[model samples]
Target: MEYSFRIQLVAIVSLMLVFPNTQGWGEDGHTIVCSIAQARLSNTAAEKVKELLPPGNDLASMCSWADHVKFYLPWSSALHYIDTPDNLCTYQYERDCKDQNGEKGRCVAGAINNYTTQLLNHGTDNSYNLTQALMFLAHFMGDIHQPLHVGFTSDRGGNSINVHWYTRKQNLHHCWDANIIETAEERFYDSNIDEFIDAIQQNITKTWSSQVEGWETCNSNETTCPDIYASEDIKAACQWAYKGVSDGSVLEDDYFLSRLPIVNLRLAQGGVRLAATLNRIFG
Candidate 1:
C-alpha cells in the first residue's frame, strides 16, 4: 500500500510539472463562456451538441477538453494562441497567423476557421472528427477572446513576465488567464463560479445587449470570422492587458478593478459568439 501511494503521488506531481500553467483561460473562465453559450444555443445546435458529446456530458463540461488534450496532441499547442510582433499591438492574419516553424494557418485564429469548416461538414462528412471539431471550436472561441492569447510574441502572451498578484508571485499571462477572474469571484460573487458566470450572462442580455448582434455578425456569408476576433483581441491586449504594469510589478486593487470589466466583456462576447457559430453550423 505504501509503495502504491508513493507511485500515485509521483504521477500526480509529474503531471503538474508538465502542465504548470494552462495557456488559455483557466478552467473557470472556459466554463463561464461555455455555460453561457449552452443556455443560448438554438434547438438544432443543442440537439447536435447532445448527439456529439459523450453520454451524460454537456458542452460546458467538455469545453476545456482541448486544453488538456493538447499535451498528447502536441500539434495543437500553437492553436491556442497567436504571438504578435512585440509591442506592435497589431495582428494581420497573413503575417501573424503562423506557428513557430513558420507554418501558415497554424495560429488560434486559423484553428477557429479550420474547425468551423470541419464542423460545417457534419452529417455529410465522416472524414473529419466532428466531435473533436465541435469541442475545438467551442474552446477556441473562448481562447480567441482572451486578450493575452493574442498578445506580444516576446513575452509569449505575458507568460514570461514575472509579476505579483497582490503579494503572491505570478506570471502576467496567468494573472489575465485566472487570477483576475478568481479575484472577482471572491470579492463580488461569493467565490462561486456559477455566480460569476451568471453575472456575465446578465450583462450579455442587459448591459451588452446592443453590441451582442454585432459581435455575432460574420462578414460576407462566412461561417466564422476569426480574423476580426483576433484583431479585436490584440487591441484589447494592448489597451487593457499590457497597459500599465511591468516585470516584477505588483497588481493590486486598482489593476484588478479596472480590468475586471474588460474580462467580463470578453467572456460575454465569447459565449455569445460561440452560440452564434454553433447555431450557424447546426441550424
Candidate 2:
C-alpha cells in the first residue's frame, strides 16, 4: 500500500483500540429485532416458543442466547455469517460457504434452514434441540440483516476494516453492528426500541412485507438462490456500508442520517421474516 494509505490505516486501527462495544449489534439491536417479531407472532407461535425457552425467557430476552452458547459450540461460530468474496457484493452458497473450511450446510443460511426444519418437526426431537433451533433462528435472522455479517471474506465481513466513528475509532463491521442502529434509535425514537418497533409495525410497506414470501421461495438446490437473504445483506454492505468508507474514515451525522432508513428497513424486514419462519414452524 502507499505510504499515505498505510499511515491512515494505522491511525484508524489506533482509534479502534480505544473504542468499546465491538460485538455484534450489542443487546439493544437484537432486542429491537426480537421485540418486533414477538409483537407480530401468532398466539400459537408465541406459545410454542415460550414452552421451549427456560422460564422467564421469551424471544426478545433469549435472542442473545445463541451468542452465549456459541462459546461452548465452537463449530457454531460460522453459523452467524456468510462471507462473500471481496468487491463482488453477492453470494453463492457454494462459492462463499464452502470456503470456510468446507463445512457444508453450516453457515447462517444453512443454520436457518436446519433450524427451520427442526422447528417444523417440533416435538419429534428433544426440547434441547427445539430450544437451540429457536434461538439460532431468532438470532441469525437479525444477523442476516446486519450487512457487515455478509460482507467480504477478505475483511472478515468488515471486521478488519479500521475506521473512526467521528474520531472515536471503530471497525467498519462494528459501525454497522452497534453504531448505526444505536444512533438511529437515539436520533429517531430517543433510544426507545419499543417506539421504533411500533412505528415499523404500523408502517411496514407492502413491498418489504411481500419479501417474506420471496425470500422463503428460494430453492435450496438452485445454486446461490437458496440463500437470497444472505445475498441481500451482501449487496447492502457493498452499496452502503463500504461505499464511502475507507481506512481512517471519520463517520458523523451525515453518514448516520443517510443510513437510518436502511437500518430501519432491515430491522423491520428481519422481524417480520423471523415471525413468518416461526409461525410456519409452530402455527
Candidate 3:
C-alpha cells in the first residue's frame, strides 16, 4: 500500500488502545523485545535459544527479557524523561554544540548513544545476562527508531502537546508512545496475538538491513540523529495542527495508517539485527 506516515501512525495509535491491558510487553520496550525475539527465532542459531526457552510462549520470554535487561542497562529509564511546557523555555536556546549549557542536548544524544553502546558491548560476560541483554538491545534499538524519543529539548518529545485520544485526554508523546500502536492493533489486527507477531516478523525480515543501517549511521555521529528528530517534529507539528486537533482528527487515522509499515519495518529490522548481533557474539 502507498501509505503515508500520518496514516500509519493513526493505525498504530488505534491498535495500541485496543489492547490497553495486554501487559508491559505491548509497550514499546516490550514490543521491541518481542520483535527481536521473533526475528531471532526465524534464524538457525536462535533455534538453540528457542529450545532453551519454554514452549508456546515466546512472548513471555521476550517480556521477561524486557524486565531483566532493565537492570544491566538502566539507561532505558531515560526514555521516560520528558520535556514539558514548564521546562520548555528553560532549555529552548541550547544549541547542538557540545558547549550547550543544559541537559536537553546532551540528554537526548547521550540516551541514544548509551543505549547503542550497551547493545554493542552486551554479552554474558561483564554481567551482561544474555537473554536480557538481547531483549534490552532489541527494545532500546526500537525505541531510538521512534523520532519523538529522540526529540527536541523544548517539548520533551512532544509531551507538551496536549490532546485528547478518543475520549481519553493525553499528550502527543504518550499518544505516540502507546496510542498509535494500540489503536492499530484494534482497528486492523483485532487483537490476534499470533497474527500480530507473524506480521511483525515478516515485515522485519523484509526491511532488516536498511533499518539497521539507518540507526547505525545515526549512532556514528557524536550528536544524536538531529535529522531524524527534526524531520519528525515537522511532521508531528503538522499532525497536531492540521490533523490531531481536538475536534478535527484527520492526522491520527491517516498518520497511523501511513506509519504502520515503517513501525513494522523497524520492528523487523530490530529483531533480525538483534539476532545477528547475538549470533556474532555467542556463536
Scored by TM-score, the top model is: 1
Residue range 155-270, candidate 2, lDDT tens digits? 89888888888768888888888888777778778988888777777667554666555543436533123276787888888888988888888999888888777887787777
Please write out the lDDT profile of model 1 over residues 1-283, one tens digit for every residue: 4345345434543564466447579888899999999999999899999987655778788788788766667899999999999888899999999999999999999999999999898878777877778888999999999999999999999999999999999999999899999999999999999988888888888998899999999999788899999999999999998899799999999999999999999989999899999999999
**In candidate 2, residue 121 scores what lDDT?**
76
Weakest 10 consecutive residues of candidate 3 by summed lDDT: 84-93
Q: For candidate 3, lDDT tens digit of each residue in 1-283? A: 2134335434543454443432222364355545555555436446645643334435433443433333434644554222323222222214431223334534333443444455445443353333333444445444544445544456555666677766677766666666766776778778655566676766544645456555434444332343343344334334332243433233456666766665565445445544554454445
For candidate 1, list the clashing residue pairs, or say none: none
Q: Count the backbone clashes (under 3 Å) in each candidate.
A: 0, 0, 45
User: Which has the greatest lDDT?
Assistant: 1
Local distance difference test values of all predictions, in order? 0.88, 0.75, 0.46
Q: Candidate 2 has which clashing residue pairs, if any? A: none
lDDT of 2 at 214: 59
Angstrom error of the Cα, residue 83, model 3: value is 8.1
Residue 91 lDDT, candidate 2, scale 0-100: 88
